[model samples]
Target: MSANIILFHSVLGLREHERHLAGKLGAAGHAVSLPDLYAGVATDDLEQGFAIKARIGWEVICQRARDALASTPGDTVLAGISMGAGVVASVWALRPLTAKVLLLHGLATVPANIRPGLPVQLHVADTDPFFPEPDVRAWQHAAEAAQTDVRIFRYPNSGHYFSDPALPDYNDTAAALLWQRVLAFLD
Candidate 1:
C-alpha cells in the first residue's frame, strides 16, 4: 500500500492512541506507519515512562525513526505525539526530509537555523504542564519567523496527552476535535 502519511508514537510506543490514528489516516488513504520506539519496554507511571524513554537513548530513538522512514514509501507527511514529535523534529533538523509535519501533544522549538514556509500543524493542551502557554507562544513566533504555516489548536483545561483515551489525561471532546483537525491537515 502506498502511504503519504506516517505517525510515530511517543516513548509509550504503538499503543491504542497511535494505532487508532494510523487507522484513521489509512482510511484517509495515507499509508501510515507507527513504529515501536520503546521496543517492549513501557510503563503506566509518568515518571517511569519518562525514565524508560530516557533509557532508550535519543540516538536509538532517532535511528528507529530513520528505519521507519526508510520503510515507508512515497513522499511522506511526518507526524507524531509527545516524544515522537520531538523525534520527528530532530529528524527534520538533521536530515531535512521533505514532508509536511503534523505535531500533536507537543511542540518542537524550531531552531533558528531552520526556516519554514511549509505547512505545519500543532495540537496541544492549553494547560499542558509540560508546554506552558508562554512557551507555545514563543514557539509560534519562531515558527512564523521562519515562514512556517503553523496552526496550533489548544484544548482548554484538558490534561497533557489528551488524545490517549487509555490515559487518565485523555479528554474525549478534545481528542475528537484534534482528530478532525488532523484529518483536515493531512488532507
Candidate 2:
C-alpha cells in the first residue's frame, strides 16, 4: 500500500542521515516530505549546529512541523530524528491526531490535554548519552499511560546519533537495522 510520510530532520537540517531513509521509504512507495526547520539557520560546525538548534527553539520547530503536516497528505505519518521527534510529538499533542508519530532518539513531554493511543515508535542507542534508559523508561511510561502503542529499539554500543553517517556517533549496523525497522513501520 502507498503511504504518505512526513519526515523531520535533526537540528542539522535535511542531510544524509534521513535522506537515505526517505529515499528508501519513498522507493518502498511512501510519499515522503522532509521539511527544513532551519530556514534561516546554517552551521558548518557541530557546536554551531547545537547552538543553532538551541536558538531556533521548539516553537519554531513546531510551527514548521505544523506546516509540514498541512502540506502533506491528510493521513501522513509524523517521522523525525532527535529534535525532530520532539516536533512530531508537539504536533501529536496539539490534536494532529490524523498523523501517526515516529520518534527516533527522543520522546515528548506528555500531558492530559493531548489524546493518547497514537502509534509511536522510538529508536535510541542503548548508551545514548542524551536519552538514558531511566529517562527513556519515563518516556515509555508516559506514552503507555496514554495507551500509545510505543515500540522502542535499543542499539547496544551506538551513540546518540547512530543513524547519522556524518557524525562520529554513526553505527552502520544500527543505521541499517533502523531503516529496516522504519520501513516496516511505514508500511
Candidate 3:
C-alpha cells in the first residue's frame, strides 16, 4: 500500500507541521516529497504569510510542484494544505495518471480533463474565511460533474488552519480527526 506522494506546503511556507505530516505519511510507508513552495521562508504571522504568498504567487508554486512531480512516479498522490490544495487543482489536469488528490483547508476546481472516478479527499473547516461557500460549492459541482470520487470532511466550528499546531486557530480534536481520516485515505 506504499505510495509516492508530493505534499505542497501552505502559504505560511514550509514549516515543522508540514514535515510532521510528511513523517506521518512516511511512517505509513509512503515516500513523500514535502516541497517548500516559498523556498525557505515560513512565518507564524497571518499578515506576513499573506504577503509572502502573494509575492510567490500560485503560478510559481505550481511550477515548483510540477518540477517535483516530473521526477516522481506516474501515480504519485498529490497532497497539499491551503494554498497547496490550489496547486494540486491547478496541475492535476496535466497529470491525468495521478493516483489521487488530497486537499487540506481548501478546495479547487476540477479540471476539464480529469477522468471519472478519480479519487479525491478534502478536509476543511465548516466555514473557512479563506475558503468561501460559493467557491466550495463550485469546486464540489465541478468534481461531481467530472465524476471524481470526492470525499469532503468539514470540521464544525473550527478555525481555517485548524490542523496547524503553531497557529492560534489550532484545534486538537479537529487535527487528530483529520489525520485519522487522512491516514485511512492513504491506506
Candidate closest to the true structure, highest lDDT: 3
Model 3, 35-133: lDDT tens digits are: 878889999887898899889876887888888778888888989898888888778888889899999997767888987898899898987998877
- State residue 134's C-alpha deviation in candidate 1, in Å: 0.9
Which residues of candidate 2, in runs, are more than 4 Å off?
40-45, 111-117
In order of listing, the candidates' clash counts read 4, 0, 0
lDDT of 2: 0.77
The model with the greater lDDT, 1 or 3, is 3
TM-score of each: 0.90, 0.89, 0.95
Clashing pairs in 2: none
lDDT of each: 0.79, 0.77, 0.88
Better of 2 and 3 by TM-score: 3
Candidate 1: 10-residue stretch with minimal lDDT:
90-99
Best by TM-score: 3
Report the C-alpha displacement of residue 59, candidate 2, in angstroms.
2.3
